[model samples]
Target: MNKRKPLDERRAEIVEAGLSVALREGVESVTVRRVAQEAGISLGTVHYCFDDKDAMLRAMGRSIAMRASEPVIAALEAGPDRRALAEATVDALLVGLKEHQEMRLLTFEFAVSGARTPVLREVAQAHLTQSIAMTREYLQRLADVAQVTWASDIDDLARMTALRIDGIELAWMVDQDDAAAREGFAVLARDVFADMRPELPAG
Candidate 1:
């Protein structure tokens, strides 16, 4: 008899299959049997990894959010000046969105699931909170590094910026017009950052 794949590997495969199904046919189509068929595993195997559809959906959401944030985090750590940091943030978002179109679809499906399922809702809220916190930290770090002060409310601005990013991502997923999406995001970022320039000393 062949040895079974490790539990972690099996779980990862199931999640990937679930994401594929959700992206292609929508979340309602991602039943345990469907995922098992997609992953070439038994339904029991899918159950062994996830408690139920809700659990699978939550796992999928977490995975997509983490994968999408990677490039943004990397760009922030690239030691760029403030303008570069701002542009990198926008560019990273656009590239990540374009590269992970399927993941974005899955994310939207999970969000809709959250509306009716408490567990999924909690998971979504937690993920959003974590994302916003990370955004706030990155913005604060950029301000400090560039010796820029924000005359307006920093926390409020950060939250607004993050929400704008989330909106742009969802819009881009549907529109798939990369040039238009990038231009819109660039304009938004430029306007936000430009408003703070007077707070910094002359370069």
Candidate 2:
């Protein structure tokens, strides 16, 4: 009897393969056959793990979002003061972008794909909504802790914050310069939250 690959391992392998294809090429290149070839698995194995390309893309998006969000959420839960929280959030986000370059690229590509593909659009929007909500919650907590009040809408601020971060990631994807991105983010954050400039903890 032939040995069988563990289900979890197989799923992970397929996702990894899909990510590889996405990063090297683009989301447009991440076909089922390509993922199987990248994983050194049969096409049937890939299909067994994922129903279709859209399913694979959705899985990939969720995996990336979860990984990227985990550190940010953890740092927020640590209850840092406002300045520290801002710095930590920026740091975590930048690190995630650097470590998950392929995932970031895939995300951007999927955003474009979402325009033409309803399934892709739904998945992309879902992740984007989750990301925005997570960011909003963190900012609200920070505001409450700092006792800073803003007249602006909190959700709107959060959406803008998320967009700013996404813009920075998009720029870095084109030019991999951590310094530029970090500096840009710092300046932007300060300008956006100019009223609440609490001193950050010593780095």
Candidate 3:
């Protein structure tokens, strides 16, 4: 007989299955029954794993936030000058967005759904907070590695960076134009985030 999977692993599988459903159908269609079906598990199993739909959604929110951070983590591995590293980080973000465009679009759908749905607001808010904090950490690490700083307040700058990326990703999702996305990100990295570069050091 097959041994049973642990609760944590089972929960992760259910979460990923739920995301796959969202990626295929719109976020609004992600009912617990639907997710259960997608996961090929019993309704009892799902119920055992999650308190309710809201709990499942909360899991999905965390999953998306974790998915979103991976590109930056990978980009951090490529050590280079501050400018190049910033550009690499931005490019990695765009690449990750492109690679998982469906999931990314679902992220927006979840946000919009949360805004209109009372039960989901906190889940969405938590994801948003986590995303901004992840960006802030990325910015902070870049600054530390490059020995530079943003002229503006780092807190505010992190918020701006997160919003700018959201706007760009949304535009790309609508247009399906990768070229325009790259151009937009290049401008974002070089022009918008130029504040990340400080003034020259005197002799």
Candidate 4:
């Protein structure tokens, strides 16, 4: 007889199965039954780990947020300069969006769903807050690399940058125009870096 998997590992496997369903057939299809089927587990097994489908969805959303942050963190670590890092980060984000358009759409769907679901709203807000903080840290690193003092408030700059990226993603969700979106992002990113350049101290 096969030994049973550990609880945490089994839960993670279920969550990933749920994510696969959401990404493929949209969030509406992420039923416990479907996830159980996808994972080749029983419904009772799924319920053993999750109290309900909503709980499983929350876990899946958190997992997605964690997985998405990996490349961004890597970009910050390996980037050469402020502008180059920022550009590389944008490119990475767009590439992911293009590759996982369905996932991108599901994220938007979850956000809209969150407007009515307090728990989900909180989760989404927490994710966005962490992402903004990460971006702020990246900007600080950029300033350090350039050996210049950033003139603007990093908090405001980070928030704005986050908003800009959200807008771009929203546009992609609507238009599905990766080529245009990327082209526009390149120009906008250049202008953004120029605008946020470090201020020179007057002699």
Candidate 5:
């Protein structure tokens, strides 16, 4: 007799299968049948976990955001100084984008789809809020580690930085020009760090 997986494990397995399909074939192809096939289960199993494709897509979107943020959080945690923090953050993001272009494309797909679907839009917004909060905490940690005071509010700086990185990635995806984008990100990092530097006291 074939052993049955626990409900939570089965759900996670189905989500992983859906993510694989989204990453490889685009989010549009993530159907119950396709996911079930990918996960080596019956179609009813996929339906049992998700009400429909929208539910699966939302789950996949959340999973994608979490996976994408891991490297960024690690980079932020690795900072010993402001310079190191900036380098690590920028380098991790750029490297990840180059290596996981498919994941980035799926993010774009989520954004566009969310614009049309109210429920999915809420999911997308939640992901964005989570990202901003995580980034703010990371920036605060960096400041504490480096013993540097920011010229602006750390919260504002974190939000701006997060949005800027997202914009840069979106633009790079469309242009398919990594060299120019890398240079642009380097310049951006320099400017952001410069803006955060506390004004020196008069000699």
Candidate 6:
């Protein structure tokens, strides 16, 4: 007999399966039964993993968002200056977005689906709130690394970060122009994050 996976592991597996199904077949096809088929597990297994379709989707949305940020978060470092830090961070971010284009597109689909699908509405709302909160934390971490503080409210910066990222991902997906995306990131580093420039120690 094969050993059963742990609960958390199983849930993660199901989340991946559901994402595959959604990305492959569209969000409407992401029923528990369909995800179970994709995962080669029984429908009951999916139920055990999630109380219902909404719950499963919530898990999937959260998983996708977490993965989307991992690369950029890993790239954050103390640079010679604030601009360098911003460039490094957003460059890693652009790489991640291009690398996982499908995943990034799926988030856009979910946002639209949330408008039409009642069950997905909460998932969409939750994701926006989650993204903003997570961005807030990331901004704080970046500031800590740079030994600086934002001249503006961190919450506002977090909201701006979340919206700008969403815009960048969508624009990149449409254009598939790496050069333009990099150019935009450069601009963001200069215009947006310049607030942290004050932290450079006086010579």
Best by lDDT: 6
TM-scores across all candidates? 0.74, 0.71, 0.85, 0.71, 0.76, 0.90
Kindly list the per-residue Cα lDDT of model 6 for residues 13-125, writing each as its tens digit. 99999999988998778998899999999999999989988889878877877888887788775453665677688788888887788887888888898889887898788
- Go through the candidates in order and give the clash count of each: 0, 0, 0, 0, 0, 0
**Between candidates 2 and 6, which one is better according to TM-score?**
6
- How are the candidates ranked when ordered by lDDT, highest leading? 6, 3, 2, 1, 5, 4
lDDT (0 to 1) per candidate: 0.76, 0.77, 0.81, 0.73, 0.76, 0.82
Identify the leading candidate in terms of TM-score: 6
The regions of model 3 sitting more than 4 angstroms off are 191-193, 197-203
Worst 10 residues of 5 by lDDT: 194-203
- Could you give candidate 2's per-residue lDDT for residues 1-203 as a string of tens digits? 75898988899889988888888888778899999999988999988988887778777877787777766666665444667766876687777788777777777788888878876787678768767886787677666766676556888888888888889989998888899998877876675566454534455
Where does candidate 6 have its weakest 10-residue lDDT segment?
Answer: 194-203
lDDT of 6 at 10: 98
Clashing pairs in 3: none
CA displacement after TM-score superposition, residue 4 of candidate 3 (Å) = 2.1
Put down candidate 3 lDDT per residue, 1-203, tens digits, no spaces.
86789999999999999998888787888888999999999999999999998789878877886786788777766654655676787789788887777777777887898899887787778777877887788888877777777888888888888888889999999998888888887877775446856753433
RMSD of 1: 3.7
lDDT over C-alpha atoms for residue 28 of model 4: 68
TM-score between candidate 3 and the true structure: 0.85
**Stretches > 4 Å off in candidate 1:** 116-158, 187-199
RMSD, each candidate, Å?
3.7, 4.5, 2.7, 4.1, 3.5, 2.1
lDDT tens readout by residue for model 5, 1-203: 98988988888899889888877887667778899899999988788888887677767766666677677677867655666777887787788788777876787787776788676786566667766776677677666766677888888888998788778888999898888778777877776667655632344
Query: Which of the two candidates, 1 or 2, achieves a greater TM-score against the reference?
Result: 1
Please give the TM-score that candidate 4 achieves against the real structure. 0.71
Candidate scoring better on TM-score of 4 and 6:
6
lDDT at residue 40 of model 2 (Cα atoms): 89
Model 4 lDDT tens row, 1-203: 96899999999999889888887787768789999999999999999999987778778766765565556556655455666666776687777667666665666678776677675686566556765776677677766655665556889888887677767878988898888778766766665566554643344
